[model samples]
Target: MASEEIQIKTDYITLGQFLKLTNVVESGGMVKLFLSEYPVFVNDSQDQRRGKKLYPGDSISIPEVGTYTVTRENA
Candidate 1:
């Protein structure tokens, strides 16, 4: 599957923020509901925590949504 790269300037980003950055959900408040309804995978393992930490090089996949790869932005 095609993977979209998400660039982050910080050391880490939460799963909720990742979802927002990718436009997978409309708002931060919707992250919880989205997680409850959909299966999200982090490094190929199921992850459902909104506060889960995601660092550069982490991979996330959500069935029917899309796959994503975290990357650090050049400073």
Candidate 2:
């Protein structure tokens, strides 16, 4: 799938937080369940850590959800 760009106000964002920021998962509880249910790819590799750090240029793929690329917005 084509990747979507997600701009962040900070230098980095956690995987779970990024999911929430992108409106992928509604809540932390949902993120936990979602992670267990589907595979999340970080820079093209399977990553299960909710605390995984995502910096600019990082890519995340949530299977059928869609892919997203991280970018630091003007801040």
Candidate 3:
């Protein structure tokens, strides 16, 4: 599937926050279950940490869900 672009004004964002930002999960409550049930890829590597720091140009991919690409924007 085609990846969705998510622009961030900050330098970095956490995986869990990003999930919620992208509406991947309904709420923060789903983050634990989502992480345990699905595989999360950060820049193509499987990562389990919700606190994973995503920098500019980083991409996150989840199977069965859309990929989110992080882009930096000047504030």
* Maximum-TM-score candidate: 1
Error of 1 at 75 (Å): 0.2
Quick one: ranking by lDDT, best first? 1, 2, 3
lDDT of candidate 2 over 1-75, digit per residue (tens) = 788999999889999999899898899878888888899999999998899999999999888899999998985
Candidate 1: residue 30 Cα off by (Å)? 0.5
Number of the candidate with higher TM-score, 2 or 3? 2
> What RMSD does each model have against the real structure?
0.6, 0.9, 1.0
After best superposition, candidate 2 residue 12: deviation in angstroms?
0.5
For model 2, how big is the CA root-mean-square deviation?
0.9
lDDT by candidate, in order shown? 0.96, 0.91, 0.89
The parts of candidate 2 lying over 4 Å away from their true place are: none
Candidate 3: where is the Cα deviation over 4 Å? none
Clashes of each: 0, 0, 0
- Candidates in order, TM-scores: namely 0.97, 0.93, 0.91
- lDDT over C-alpha atoms for residue 41 of model 1: 99
Give lDDT tens digits, candidate 3, residues 6-40: 98888898898899999999898898899999999
